[model samples]
Target: MNVTGDDVRSLALSLPETTEQFAWGMPIFKVSGKLFLTLPEGETSMAVRCPILDRDELVLAEPAKFWIAAHEAGNAWVRVYLSALDDREELTAIVTDSWRQAAPRALLDSP
Candidate 1:
């Protein structure tokens, strides 16, 4: 099964409750205006804001696209190749994690 931008959007929307918008000319999934993920038109790959340690690990594992050591957000985010995802299950988990981190507990508690 091929992953598409629609899949990305759907995954993001599936989160508890969040918002979608664009930033830096790319699609951004956020909660209360803070970006959680960003991807270009095709959504072939996505960048998730991460801590310095996690970013280091990802860059070492996949040096080609998972660039770091020099970035706009520096060590605050890392790009994840959509193709690197073993299956839709992993993709969903990762996307959900990003959303959960971005979404505040209060928002999730909202009825």
Candidate 2:
């Protein structure tokens, strides 16, 4: 199944303390006021917080699915093509991972 921006939004909002806001004329998801994900203007791809160290590897390993916007090159974020996603499960994993990165420690420790 194809993963769309709506799927990304739903998965993102499902995470604890996640909220949607608009910025740069695009939808952005935040956890406890910390940005974790963003759906750029086209909604065809999403930018998610990623460890700077892992970003290069992900992009190099799967250029079709992952990439770093030139504007975000020095930041710890990577853009993921929604159309390239394999399934909802994969989307969940990706969205949740980003949420975890931005989620507060208390939220992370919660059962």
Candidate 3:
């Protein structure tokens, strides 16, 4: 199933304490002022928090769906091709994981 920008926005914003902000002409989602997700490349893709090692592995495992932008290569971020996502559940998982990474420790333990 293909994921749209609306899907990205909804899933990201549904996460605990997530908020949206505009930057670089794109919608970015943050957890307590820390960015966790962003709609980039005409909203066709989304960048999310992911460790460098894991990002590389994901790209290698699914080049069609995962990649690192040249400008973001130095950061712990991975780009996911929305059109190539497996389904809503996968998108939710990705957004949730990214949110968890950016959320504060207190938020993580909170109910």
lDDT of each: 0.72, 0.92, 0.93
- The TM-scores of all predictions, comma-separated, are 0.78, 0.96, 0.97
Clashes of each: 0, 0, 0
Residue 72 CA error for candidate 1 (Å)? 3.6
Stretches of candidate 1 exceeding 4 Å from the true structure: 108-111
Pick by lDDT: 1 or 2, better one: 2
Superposed by TM-score, candidate 1 places the C-alpha of residue 77 at a distance from the truth, in angstroms, of 0.8
Backbone clash tally for model 1? 0
Candidate 3 per-residue lDDT over residues 25-103, each given as its tens digit: 9999999999999999999999999999999999999999999999999999999999999988899889999999999
The numbered model that scores best in lDDT is: 3
Candidate 2 structure quality by residue, lDDT tens digits, 2-50 = 8889989888888888899999999999999999999995899999989
* Model 3 vs. true fold: TM: 0.97
| Model 3 local distance difference test score | 0.93
Q: Model 1's lDDT to the true fold?
A: 0.72
TM-score of 2: 0.96
The weakest ten consecutive residues by lDDT in model 3 span: 10-19
Q: Considering only N, C-alpha and C atoms within 3 Å, which residue pairs clash in candidate 2?
A: none
Error of 2 at 95 (Å): 0.5
